[model samples]
Target chain A: MNRKLRDLGERRLVEWIVRRLEECEGASLPPGDDAADMLFRGRLLVSCDMLAASTDIPPGMDLRDAGFKAITSATSDIAAKGGKPIAYLVSLMLPPELGLESFEDLWEGFEEAAKLYGGRIVGGDLNSGREIVVDVICIGEAGRTASRLGARPGDILAVTGEFGSQAAGLHALLAGRLEDPEARRVVERFSRPMARVREALELAKTSAVTASIDSSDGLAESLYQLSELNDVGFLIDDPPISAEAERYAEKFGVSLFDLVFYGGEEYELVLTLRSKLVEKAVKAVEGVGGRLIPIGRVIEEKLIKVRWADGWRMLERRGYQHF
Target chain B: MNRKLRDLGERRLVEWIVRRLEECEGASLPPGDDAADMLFRGRLLVSCDMLAASTDIPPGMDLRDAGFKAITSATSDIAAKGGKPIAYLVSLMLPPELGLESFEDLWEGFEEAAKLYGGRIVGGDLNSGREIVVDVICIGEAGRTASRLGARPGDILAVTGEFGSQAAGLHALLAGRLEDPEARRVVERFSRPMARVREALELAKTSAVTASIDSSDGLAESLYQLSELNDVGFLIDDPPISAEAERYAEKFGVSLFDLVFYGGEEYELVLTLRSKLVEKAVKAVEGVGGRLIPIGRVIEEKLIKVRWADGWRMLERRGYQHF
Candidate 1:
C-alpha cells in the first residue's frame, strides 16, 4: 500500500521523521524540544545550503541521493573551513503528491550522511511546496579556520584527491552507460560524493595549512576566487586528474582540460600550506588514511596560469553558475 | 532600469547581497568566507524554518513582508525556547526572472529584521529555483529554556499578548476592507507580526516560567501540543482576545470564539508560570515593556476546555494544517 504525504499530514510526517533519527549523545534537548541545543567550546562554524529538485538534482538521481547531497554539500563548506560537523538542521519543502516511501528514502539518505560525518540530524521542519527542496544548516566547531583570504606568495598549493571523476560520472550517466564496468567508478563518484572532512580535520590540526576551500565550484573558479581574495596567483605544473576521467575523456573525445578545470561537484579540498612544512602536512593527511596531492605553488602575479602544450596558459575564471 | 537576476549572474548577485550586510562585531569570518563563525558561552539554540512564496505569502503582502516574516517566524521558535538570537544564516532559492529592485526590497526586509532582533545576517547561499523560497536558520543562546514538557498541574497559564488580530487582519485583507479605519490596525498586525523575544528572555530569567510555546499554529493547537507533551490540560477562563479582533468579529458576524481559538500567525507566547511566583513573572515581563496576561490554570485531565456562556466546553484540538 503506497501512502501519499497528504494522507500522513504534516504533523504525522514530522513525528515519523523524528522517530527515525538516532538519539544524539549529550543532547540536553532532543528533537521534540522547540529548538536543538548544541554545546561548543570555541568558534562555531555555520553553513546553510539549499538543494532544489529543479536545478540541483540531475537526471537519473533518486530522492535519497538528493537528501544525501543536501547535507553533504552543505557540510562541504564546513570541511573547507577545517571544521568537524556537530549537528545538522534540515528543512524540507516537498510537493503534496509525494509518496511516504519516497520521503522515507530521502530521510534514509540523510541518515547515511549522518553516519558518515558523525553529525546528528537533531531537528527539522517539513512544509508543502511545489517541488522537493531541501535546505540544510550545518553547525560545527573550528580552531584556526583556513579562510579563502590567507594564501600568500610561495605557499604550496595542494588538494585532497584527484578531480574530474564527478564530471565524467555525470557524462556517463547521461549517456546511458551505467552498465559499463568502466563507467561504474565515475558514476559512484557522482552519486555518492564524499566531503573531505577527515582530511581537513587532520590537516587543520597540523598548524601548517594556510588557506583552504572546497572544490565544489570547479578548479579554475576556486583558484580564481583564492587569487582575487588573497591578491595572489597560482602556477599549476601538474593537474590532479583522475584515471577514470582520463579514460572517459579519451573515449568520448572530450577535452581533459575542460573536465578538470571547468567541471564541478568534486568536493575535494583545494588548500595552501607552508612551503617548508609541506612534508609534515602530507604526513598528517596520510596519517588519517587520505592522500595529499600537491598541484602547484602560489605566485606573486595576479593571474592563474597552468602548464599547457607549449607553455603557461591563463585559466578562465568561470565555473558552475547556480542562477 | 530593471535588471533581472539572469543579467547579474550568481556570483555578482552574491557579492551585492554581501555588501549590503552590516559588519558583525567579533565575527572572525564574514559572508564571503567559507563558513561563518559565532562565539557563544553556553548552550546554543538552533532553529531553521522555510518560507515559500506560494504557501507562505498571502494575497496583499509584498516581497519585503515575505522577507521580514521569513526571519521573524523562525526567530519566534527561538524566542519560544527563551533564547536570544545571536546570528542568522539565510539560504535563498530564487527564480531567474526576478528583478534586482525586487530582490533589493527583499534584502531590505531582512535588514529590518536584523536590526530588530540584533542578530547579524552572517552568511548564506543563492540558488536558482522555480520560485522564491527563503530558509532561515537562527542561532541563539539561552540561560534556561522553557520547553513544553515542563508544564505541570496547578500552574498558571499565561500569554505574552492578546490574539485574533492577525486572523482579523487576514480576513480584512482578503475581503478588500483595507481602507477601513479599524481594519488598518488588524491588517498591520497580520502583516507585521512581532515575536515575543524580549518577554521570553525576561520571563526565563525570572525563574518563574514553566512551559512555553509560540502561538503561530493557533491558540488551540498550541494548547493541545502543550497538553500532549506534559500530559496536562488547559482551562482558559479568560481568553485573551484582542479588542480589534472582537470589533472585527462583531462587525462581520464572525465567531469571536473561533477567532480567539483557531486563528494563527499571532507570534504570541503561550506559557505556564509557577503559581506562587506569578507576580514576579508578571513584573519581569512588564519590566521589558511587555504584558503577561493570565488566562487560566493547568488541570489534571488531559483535555482542553474554555469557559463559555453556561459552563466550560471542550475546545477542539485543531489549528492551521500546512498540508
Candidate 2:
C-alpha cells in the first residue's frame, strides 16, 4: 500500500528523514536534538537562500533539480567569500498534498548536492504551506575571506567560467527546445550550475585576489555590486559570452547583450585581483581544472562601461531582482 | 510618496535593511559577504524555522509580529538545548506589491526580537514570492546541552510556566472575542510567547536535568516526543493547565482537556530531572522569574497514562501535525 504523508504523522516523517541522513563529519550531536551541534575551525561564514516554487523554479525543472539548485545557490555565496562549506540547515515548506516519493526525491537531490560540495545536511525544519519553499542556510569556514569592498581602482577584473549559458538554457526550456542536444547541455547548466568552491578557495590562499562575488545575478549586476561596494567603476574590454548563448540568441532573435549581461543564475565567481598577479591567479584556477577569464579593469570613475562593436557604452545596472 | 517594493528594487531594499541592523556581537565580518562570520565558544548549536503567511499567521496579527514570531520560533529550539543564541540569518520572501513602510515594519520586528533574545540579525536573503514567508536560521552556543534521549525511568517530568494560555489566546482570536480583557491577555500570549532560554540555561548548568524539549507542538506531543526518544513512558499526576485556560474553556463550552493537552505554540521547555533534585530545579527556575511545575514522572512502561478526576486514563497521542 502507498502510505500517504498524513498517515505517517510528523514524528514518523522525521524518523524517515533522520534515517536517510549520513553521519556528518563535524557534527557532535545527532539529528534528534533541539539543534544540531558542530565543531568548526577558523572564522565561520553563514549565508541563506530561499527558493520558492512560484518565483525560483522555472519550467521543465523537477523537484530534484529545485532542491539541488536551492542548496547550490546558497553555497555559491560561500564560494564568493572564498570559504569552504562545512554544513547546511534546510527548512522546507511543502504543500499538504505532496507525496512521500516526491519528498524522498527532493531529499535525494539535496544529498547529491551536499556530496558534490563536500558538505553535509546536519539539521532542518519541515512545515506545511501552499507552495514548495526550500530555504538553505549554509555554514562555511575561512582563514582569510574575500569581500566586494576590497577592490581597488587599478585591480584587474576577472571571472571564472563562461557566462550566459544558464540564461540561454532557461530560454530554450521556456521555448520547448528541450530535445536539441545543445539546448539540453545549456539547460543542464541551468539545472546544476557548479559553485566555484575549489577555485575561490585557491584564490583566497593567495594575496593577489581582493574583491569577489558570485555571479548568480548576472555578470553586469555582479560588476555593479562590486563597483558600488568599492566606489569604483569597471571597464570591460571583452564580454565573455558563451558560444551556446550566442547561438540561442541568434536563433531566437533575442539580444545577445541581454543574454550575456543581464541573465542570472550563472554561479561563477567574479573577482578583482592585482594586475601583476593576474598570471598567478590564472595558474591557480587552471590548476583546479578551471579557467580564469580576465575581461576588464577597475577604474576611478564610478560607472560601468562595456566595449561593443560600435564603441564604449555605459551599461544600466540591471539584473534579476526578486521584487 | 509611498514606494512599492518593486519600484525600490532588490538593491535599494537591501540597503534599507543594512542600515537598520546594528553591529551584532561576535560577528567578525559585516553583512555583505557571502556569509556573515561569527566567533564562538563551546559547541555550536544551529536550528532553523520557516513561517508562511497562509498557515502560521492568524487574523489581526501584523507583519511585525510575524517577523518577531518567526525568529522566536527558531530561538525556542536553541533554548530547548540550553543554548544561548548568538546570531540569526533571516530570509524573507515578499510579494512585490508590499509597501516600503510595511517592509520597514517587518525588519523592526525582527530587530526587536533579536534584541529581546540577546542576539542580532547578522545576514539574510530577500526574494519575491506570492505571499510573505520568513525563514529564520539561528546559531547558538552551549557548554553542556540537554537532549530528548537522556531521560531515565525515575526522572521527574517538569515544565516551565503554565500550559494552554497560547491555545486559549488562539481560540479567543479565532472566535472574534478580541475586546474582552481576558481574551486579549490570552491573545497577547499567543502573539508573543516567551522562549524559556534563561531557565533552560540555568537547568543545563546543574546535574539534575536529564532530558529536555520545547513544547511548541503541545504538552502531550512533547511528552510523546520524549517518550519515543528515551524508549520510555510518562505517568502524569498533574496536567499543567492555566487558570485562565480553565475559565476560557468554561465560558466557551469547550473541552478543557483538549485545550491543555493538544494546543500548540507554547514555547515552554519541558524537562525530565532527577527526583531528588526537584527542589533545586524549582529554585533555579524561580531565580529567573519563572516557575517549574512538576506534572509527571518517567516510567519503564512504554505507554503514557494520565491521572484525571475520574481515574487513570490512557492518553491518546494527538497534537498538531504539519502534514
Q: Pick the candidate with the highest DockQ.
A: 1
- Top lDDT model: 1
lDDT (Cα, tens digit) per residue for candidate 1, span B1-323: 89999998998998898886554555677567878886656778888889888888877877887788888888999999998888888899999999999998888888798679878888888889998999988888888777777899999999989988988888888888878888888988888888889998899888888888898889998999999889999898988989999998898888888888898888899999999999999999999899999999999999988997688889997787766
lDDT of 1 by residue, A29-108 (tens): 65766688765567789888888988878788777887888788889999999898888988889998899999898998
What clash pairs does model 2 have? none
What would the TM-scores of all predictions be?
Answer: 0.97, 0.97
What is the Å distance of residue A130 in model 2 from its true position?
0.8
RMSD of each: 1.6, 1.7
Reference-based lDDT, residue B290, model 1: 95
